[model samples]
Target: MSTSPPPLTLEADAVTRITRWVAVGALLALIALCLAWELWLAPTGRRTLVIKVLPLLLPLAGLLKHRLYTYRWVSLLVWLYCAEGLVRATSEPAPGATLAMIEIALCLVLFAACAVQVRWRLQRAKAAAALG
Candidate 1:
């Protein structure tokens, strides 16, 4: 009788390791861009709304879809962003410079939260999968 192992699955452990790093790197890069903008950009509130916040969100969206981040938390964060944007838009004088700054800051916080949540989820999943 043959004692050969089954053919390697596409989801080999090593591939998951590589994928985890790739996911982390991509999210970190996006987060870094937000940090750069927050730190370096002058307090002029000069950027477009869609251009500024939308890109900041792409990573979180990816994380949620990929299960790198928890779906529930990511969904909540998306809702918060939408609410903040709406509030800032409606609050007198077009969200104001201060409001814009607040928006960006909140975005940074949300991204950080997503990062933490994704790491936690990945660790939990890894542990659960290893118990067999």
Candidate 2:
């Protein structure tokens, strides 16, 4: 018999896929809005840099939603983004503070949704594994 344990598994579902993409879509929309604000409404310089960094989160989010791998890594990333947002919030002044807070809240929501997706996928995989 093999000595190693089984690889982690997922039980991706259609509705789950749709839901994940919906979340991803909303995040992307936020990203676009941030970019627009950065290019338009934002004061300039570092704010653009800070918010532009957000686009980097997209690929990992897409990968997670696609089930390219287990969702744990993505969850960690989302948590990191939330932390970054919080740090930004602390540094923000009156006008920008609200936007920073909004970003933080959205990140938290994304984190929860991704975590739930992972849990739900694992549960389905476990049920299938048991049945088989």
After aligning candidate 2 to the native by TM-score, how far in Å is the CA of 30 from where it should be? 3.7
Give the Cα lDDT of each candidate.
Answer: 0.50, 0.62
TM-score of 1: 0.34
Tens digit per residue, CA lDDT, model 2, 25-106: 6466557555655565545576646465554465655554467353556566656656756886798775456666777777
Model 2: colliding residue pairs: none
Clashes of each: 0, 0
State, as a TM-score between 0 and 1, how close model 2 is to the true structure. Answer: 0.68
The Cα error of candidate 2 at residue 72, in Å, is 2.8
What's each prediction's TM-score? Answer: 0.34, 0.68
Q: After best superposition, candidate 2 residue 16: deviation in angstroms?
A: 1.3
